[model samples]
Target: MTAIRDDGSERDRVLANGAVMAAGTVVSRMSGFVRSTLLAAALGAQLHADVFNIANTIPNMLYILLAGGIFNAVLVPQLVRAMRNDPDGGDAYTSRVITLAALFLAVVSVLLVLAAPWVMELLLDSRFSEPALAAQRDSAIDFARYCLPQVFFYGMFVLVGQVLNARGRFGPMMWAPIANNVISVAVLALYLVVFGPAQDVFGAFSADEELLLGLGSTLGIAAQFVILVPYLRSAGFRYRPRFDFRGTGLGHTLRLGVWTVLFVIVNQVAYTVVVRLASSGTASSADGTGYSIYSSTFLIVMVPHSVVTVSLATAILPRLSARAAEDDLPGLSRSLTDTLRSALAVVLPFALLLPVIATDLANVVWGHGAAAAHYELYAPSLALFGAGLAFFTVHYLMLRGFYALERTRTVFWIQCAVGGTNIVAALVLVRATDAEHTSPALVLAYSASYLVGAVISYAVLHRLVGGLRTARLVRFLVRAAIAAGLSTAAAAGTAYLLHRAAGDPHWVVAAVWVVVTTCVDVAVFVALARVLRLGEVTTVVDTILRRVRPRHVPS
Candidate 1:
């Protein structure tokens, strides 16, 4: 991995970090393949949806407690400063923070477990009205209860991951999530074999399949936390379970944590509401199935999105934290700009083209199901949603910037505006649509609103920073769009023809078409980027190829 420079542009650091982040992300994503595929096959779409819905909710809630407001945005940056200034003293401080965080997460997890039923009913009341739906709700509640303690582990990972990130030691840190996913998938596979699916596991006890799945999930969580201990040890950090927050910047971390909680809470509400909207009109079991389908499809889409976002944020944050610690504005600004451009370059085509091939790709990877329509609904949204990642990432960077400066309120307000917009759009679009399915519409609205928010955020951020260099970005975007547009058109056409040729097995044929077309798209995208002099793409590829071929290996 390339070491990030304090003097380097944000773009350079983001690219370097993104590459590192991408490594972890790709592994995590591959592991997700194991997790999701097994989950899908074992649970099927309906139960899978419940598993994901509950699983997704757990992380969001945990982020609030662990990753929320100021901890990530503000407290972490402050901690990074202390560490840079005095590594020994800072380690002591971090140790305290870790202690405090674990306590907080443990208490919260217990409380949440106790309150799981009420919580589930409250969040998903709309879907649980029918008797069948009530059963699913009960299952989710039980599942959520068992999996709640994973929150502590989740918080530990983020807290530690941020610490690693600050030191520019990202490769192992990023891979931690892959470990988590791999563990989750393995546990799930074991559960399926021993129990013959979640329903069967619960069959003797009249246990809800959702609840049983949740039980299996916690086994995965154990893996998530266990793998990180070794990584932390390698980084020369050990967690002693002690709480000495007397003067360890606990006040600042808590203050930031409050806002982080608020922001995450709002986001979680919007997401759940949107899912509830999607489940409308279906029978309770169908609703369960619909939600599961959406969850699985969403997870599939998130593989790329998560990879990009996490990579960009993880790569850039530490460097930004370092610069912020030193109050280096010009260095920070330049770096921030570069990060945005690099993120855009990497994410643009996926954002644009995924919708075009969403269904084909979904059918290929997930196979067919009642919830297949859910995937179709989600695919277009994924494409459109890619537009906002850079903005969201920049928003995160800026928040981290502000947090480093002890500016918590700024992060809060921005999240409010953006999160509020997302909620409103989700509600209005989801409710307004008259189509049999509303989930896609809900996703589209949510995704498109982010696009709008990004534009606004970018404009405001640019004004704050004086100006951004747009000529190069504009040229690249235009050329890349044209290339992707043409490429997708070709891929779609080829898939259509192959579909006709394959007759009954159109999905199988479509799968082959996606691979072929994507290959073509990649070739065209690279060619276009090279011709347009988009240096980032070439730089990334060159680095990868160089790494792949050792100096002594004759290719």
Candidate 2:
């Protein structure tokens, strides 16, 4: 198993990594669809939104802090160095680090559980004024308690998973999330079916609905943990219960990890603040239904965001680390630029299409409910928020570079600056908006924050790389915008035609629109790329399809 290099022709690496990551992500995202659908059906939008928003925030933050934020940034580079410097002790170092991370995260999980009440109070903001609403907040906190523990399991899983990835055993790490989603969907279904009509188990109707959902979902978390053990074992790794601090490489990781945690805390706190602003409800109602609406909408938009972020981050970070170690600055620069272009190309259609079909997608996936209004509010956000995916992907890759050079503090402060801007923007937007509406204002604020941050990130990268081929990048963006416009029109037309012909069955309409939009988007982009002599676009698409195509398959 030869290690994949992130040198020269970085566009090729980006395309190859994007394809694999996208395929796996598609499966995991499908599972998310199933999970969200089930929860919506079982508990309606308000309850489902409440649970999803809070419960996810816990692990979401943990994931950023550990696996995504710190672990990849810190763990991979350290492990790679260990493997290079002391080949014989590679396994021992891996084992000790895995043990320490697990123990540390386990303690963190306990602390989070203990502090759930306070965390919930902060996130829910004005949403929980009434006694019933307060109870719902407690229910959310309990659910958070259940979901938070999985961070420990997943954190350890990623530590070992990265080792496998470092060894060129990429398949298992890529597919693990699919298995986790499967377990989640299965458990949610089982709980709903078995406990749905039982008043004692589903406390939504009984005095204990909150506890049941909390405990039941925790069982789902345990299932997710169980699924990863075999994958870990197969990767020639095992988690032993030990915490060693002597020459275990914790120092290198800790410096980065602490900053990474702050970065994540700032990032998530901004998100939570947005949710809080929206949840604070309109000044007129005081019921906080606005928060519910925003929460529901955010979940739908996040599907594409998650898919894009995970796809690129998982594949690019390790390779970026290796590139930095060799001081291959040009290779690193090319890789980052190519990845940005390709990621933008890939995500643009979704960014356009989602807003066009937001109504149908929301109704189909979540059903007609109080969430319908929320969906509409969240629709434009899909495009605005989705466009940021490429920028965020670049930011993720750049942070990895920072870590590869062991510049943890730089990564930390950069994140804080970006995240702080978002928080302040959200607060100011909500404060300045008319008392009657705040959700859209907050969403706009978020989008604006990303825009500003992305510009800063690009400027920093420019200084670091001694400048990129701005002319080429500008041309690509122009071409991509044209492609997106054509695709958006195609999606809108297809959606309208399908609705008129089929009388708008949500599921069928969504399916047809997805197909039509995807085909048109790809076709138009390819044509524009060729017409404009954008070789990178053609080169990337050709390389990706070539690599993935079966021997028996035609070119």
Candidate 3:
């Protein structure tokens, strides 16, 4: 009975933490949507936008290539172990880790800024070197110079957030991004007020305009990192410089991170290929199809994953690590399965219905200011990305499983397979298709890559754990697929009828369809879940009610 009570308490704690993280994620994503919308309005989905997007993306790519993969994948488990066993509650170790990471990232950021031009030339499409795109290439270099410093801030934010997570604080990491998005939205709004939207191409932007955008973006990242410091203090963590690094188990941590570094290198190689392909579309005659559109659509598809899957994973990872540390494979397996089911219960419906209403959703989100004309460009890729959402979520969760087990090499090899597939498929698709039409195909390749990743991850995880409740997971997924299909069909048919009756796809029509279709789809899904008696659905509903309902007052 005591064990059962403890298990129930643990379950409740996980749900509560997940709810907090989910709420934070929802706020962050909503703010991010605002930020993206403002950016789209300010820049439009053209070459100028592509240049800015690509330049801004380079910092993150560089970070992953250098340190992000290690910090993200290896540090949490190590920190958790330290917290549990170390005499000082891992304080000195944490400080040393943070100090070293900051110094490393600072050096990397400076070097990257100096190397911005060469880096741009290497990562960007060859079309940028052509006489027509020379100006765009130059602007990209300038933007990179300003944005590259964000690598340091990005590393800081993730390291501090991981420290918070190790101490069982999850909400701050998820919530901190809201401040970043808010700052970015304000900057973009100011840009719109001042510059009045970018002219058609990249060459039209002046130097001051480039500085405004580049510096504003970097400032937002700085703000994101700054806000987390106080939270770390509030969590009883104080920053103290610890320079003594040798013989402190830091070597072991670094050794564990080696494979993660390789993993991210492979992943970045694939992303570089995609970036080249996507950016090539900017040179095409298509008005709104390019890297910017692909990136924006990808952002939309990730909303559910970020809000649901990431929240659950963050909440459960420390616990998973604890179980793995204890050699409690059964507990770890149960925890992972429950977390996966919970994530899919929410994500599967969105994945299914998003494609059906992608156009309306895109218009509703992006149809404002100068962006209205290009809103339709986002739908095709959004739809394609939606198809692979579940697979991507599964793959992410499986990677976390490996991280908990400290199996970085296995994770590295799996990413190699995933990245190899993505690179090959992207090359073929880009070479075969017109640049203007490559967005959907690129998205398809993304989904396929994850499909391969999910399969490989599941097989390995199943074997590692002696069994991952594969039969149960398979049955649950089948039921979910069935329910999602019926929900999507119902929603799509309703949307079509509504569109026909409205006689147009105006923003107003799109808005109404978004509302009507989402309602009908969710209703159908819930009804099917009831009829099917899906346990995950019940768990989700009960958890939500538990969160929202008023508790009885104690006498």
Query: Which candidate leads in lDDT?
Result: 3
RMSD of 2: 4.1
Q: Candidate 1 lDDT, tens digit per residue, 281-382?
A: 233333323455555566765665567666776676666666655666656666666656555566666665676666677666555433333334444444
Off by over 4 Å in 1: 1-14, 65-67, 87-89, 191-212, 279-289, 368-406, 434-436, 470-472, 503-508, 553-555
lDDT per residue, candidate 2, 1-555, as tens digits?
Answer: 345564456555655665676666667777877877666555553444554455655665656655566666677787777776676636777777777667778888888878877767776666465665655565667677766776776676666667776655555555666666676677667666655522221122333555555555555555545565676567665646656677666686776678767777777778777767765653234333345445556666666555555566656666677777777776666666666676666666566766666656666666533333333443444444555554555566566556766777666678777788778887887788663456666666766666666776667767776665567789888877776777678667766766676654555566566566567766776787787776666775687678667778677
| TM-score (C-alpha, index-matched) for candidate 1 | 0.87
lDDT of 3: 0.87
Predictions in order: lDDT: 0.61, 0.63, 0.87
Best by TM-score: 3
Off by over 4 Å in 2: 1-14, 62-68, 126-132, 191-208, 232-243, 282-309, 368-380, 432-438, 496-507, 547-550, 553-555
Ranking by lDDT: 3, 2, 1
Between candidates 2 and 3, the TM-score winner: 3
- Provide the global lDDT of candidate 2 against the true structure: 0.63
Instruction: Please say which candidate is ahead in lDDT: 1 or 2.
Output: 2
What would the TM-scores of all predictions be? Answer: 0.87, 0.85, 0.96
